[model samples]
Target: MALGGNPIFNGKSFRGATQAPRVPSYPQSQPGYGQPQYGQQQYGQPQYGEPAWSTQQMSSDQLQQMYKMYNRPSAGPAETGRMTFDDVIVKTAACLAVLLIGAAISLFVAPGTSSLLMVVGALGGFVLAMVNTFKKQPSPALILGYAGLEGLFLGGLTRFLDALYPGVGLQAVIGTLAVFGVTLALFKSGKVRATPKAMRFFMIAMLGYLVFAVINMVMVWTGVVNSPFGLGTSVHIFGIPLGVFIGLLAIGLAAFSLVMDFTSIEQGVLQGAPERYSWTAAFGLTVTLVWLYVEIIRLLAILRGDD
Candidate 1:
């Protein structure tokens, strides 16, 4: 989303959409512009065979007409490397396909093997994510590769969690879809937006959330809190688990992130961003969806943890 430091949309020159040079108007070569029009009489056309033309005899209107004759038609958006809604949809589908393939592979593996896959997928996905994110030009292979790796991670993690919290995976899937649908509707209706003020607030909240996440991780690792879910489990507010509040907040943040993703994609399409960057748009949306799904599932799991 347009939240504080989303590097994907914030990078220079490599961002989703960029300003393109105006289409050019091609003029005749005018090879001998300075000299009298080649092969023409000193005064003007000879009024005989091969009626010659000279630069001196040329009028502004005539020059303009001649130039217009050579001028080329403007390039269409596809030719200009501009983004389109179709490009986003197509590329997103490809990424999702690859993701599902990876996830399928992880799903049926032995429990022991699934655990190993989870670790490998998580680490490998993180590495690939960074590589794809910072590249100046969009790479279909890398973007799809990231999707596949993340699918492995998601599948393994989901399998592990689902074992403990039965039906959480399905619930999360429904929740993710519901949120996506509602958010898209709101965005299309112009009810929800990534306005400057809203984005500022998003960024601040995201930063605070990141800080808390890091501290909580440290606390768990250092045995400061023995809860499996870190401080989210140890702390309670108003008789509910902190994670419920945090998870709800996180879900809200992720929901807004989808808006940012939509904004970026819409901007790219409207700006006629390079067609290749459609992959970028697709990747951005996938990341947001995955984040949203994970948050939703985790929240559900946490709510059912004590049960």
Candidate 2:
């Protein structure tokens, strides 16, 4: 299934306002004398071995004014505070910590209860996720809320899967981490990028996947399929469950989306974008990780069920 909750752009463009430059210090015809000229030597010959004044010693106000005038942060990618790919990684890890804590609580509180934690986590997480995604500006409150919701879902899912297949939760955790780590390394190594062709393929494949998911959900609700997995159980390739193959394809697509996220963050940092967008980077990453985890967990479940 496709990961839900992508941030929506309301089609608003950020317009930077331009103010008129400060008037020239003096008319072109006038001599420069208003500002202190310490570097000036007397019209007569200088006394032997006297030191010269340095611009490095300007007062803080003078330096700030100079920066405002000439070094104004460029409108393009070179804006200040834009988050780097490295920053996203660190933030994502921190968010994951919060998620793990929530999961731990669910596991301990209501062990082996499917609807209890999973429903709470899924519905709660989905609500908070919407709040965070559609928010005009990011808030720590909403982001943390999303994290907690995801944790509950993960914990319940882990407990359920682990009960069926001992240590499966641990395996899934390790697998998720390994995938994220390797994908990041490959992205940083410059061997992978979100090329035009790839993105187009991803969009089309994602659309097809979404349609299948909606149809499956309808089938389940209509009692057309007794299995919880719907069409995945009915369809098979050479005796292999269709869900397994579809899950693999979905995982591949999610992994490539991570690559695109990495590329976008890289461009933002190198262009010097405003630092506030780090939250956007964090959000994108969280979305991908959740998708990855869900895919892995579901794939494991399908394989286990195959037996």
Candidate 3:
């Protein structure tokens, strides 16, 4: 399907999807081949090379049926078992709804318990993400489960951060939405694209980002940095916390990842991907969005902490 840089879609090829069916053609009657000539017919005698029944004239009912069949609209992508934009949208919305429900449940839980669930959510989400990414076909239950876990993680994290920095969660949500809207608009307008060169750069940057994240996590775990954000807050660049720059970079990466997602979905639709693969598309989007939301909220929290 010539998918873009999103790993979820990189190796997928909607194998079993079928194209639209072709219209059936009716055979036309030939004058001399299957029927006797006007003056050559003999009573109770069969003509050579002619069938017992003549097909010289079609009934008015048959003609009308043919006309109706010819004029009937062709099957659409959904009817043909192919993926469509609507499928992606509907499935994505379903995933997000489940995520929101999970978040709401986590948000109302006790703080200490919420933290434990958040940790569980984080670990569980990571495992499911890997599973979904490598699976040959999409599974809705697993995808929705991943989304729900992410919501739990996000809800707990937001609760923790927002308690210390009032309104930060709402601000982060607005920021995430703004970035998403802008990126989508630019993509649709052809102003931004996941070109080959851009994708290469994205991969390189993602690798660096992952390396730094791992290092930061290790430092936090080992007590090498006493700060809540590990080296992000401990280190400063021109009196600005290093995390600020890192956060911006991560958000940018996430935004660009959305472009990759859009590119893959567009290609899938154009190439007649199977309808079931729309779940995969929805899963990819949810993953990117969860990453984006985390980065944005963390950035906001860092800024608020600095203040």
Against the hidden reference, what TM-scores do the models get? Answer: 0.81, 0.74, 0.87
Error of 3 at 4 (Å): 0.9
In candidate 2, where is summed lDDT lowest over 10 consecutive residues? 1-10
lDDT of 2 at 85: 60
What is the alpha-carbon lDDT of model 1 when measured against the actual structure? 0.83
Candidate 3 regions with alpha-carbon error over 4 angstroms: 15-60
lDDT of each: 0.83, 0.73, 0.91
Predictions ranked by TM-score, top down? 3, 1, 2
Candidate 3 per-residue C-alpha lDDT over 1-307 given as tens digits, one digit per residue, 9 for 90 to 100: 4367799886787543554468999887656675766677767877778687644577888888988999999999889888999999999999999999878877899999889878988999999999999998899999999999999999889889999999999999999999999999999999999999998999999999999999999999999999999889999999999999999999999999999999999988988898899999999999999999999999999999999
Of candidates 2 and 1, the better by lDDT: 1
Tell me, by TM-score, which candidate is best. 3
Q: Can you write out model 1's per-residue Cα lDDT over 111-185, one digit (the tens) per residue?
A: 888888878888888888888788877889888888988888889989989999999989998999999999999
TM-score of 1: 0.81
Candidates sorted by lDDT, best first: 3, 1, 2
Residues 7-53, model 2: lDDT tens digits: 32221122231234578795556346654346654565445585454
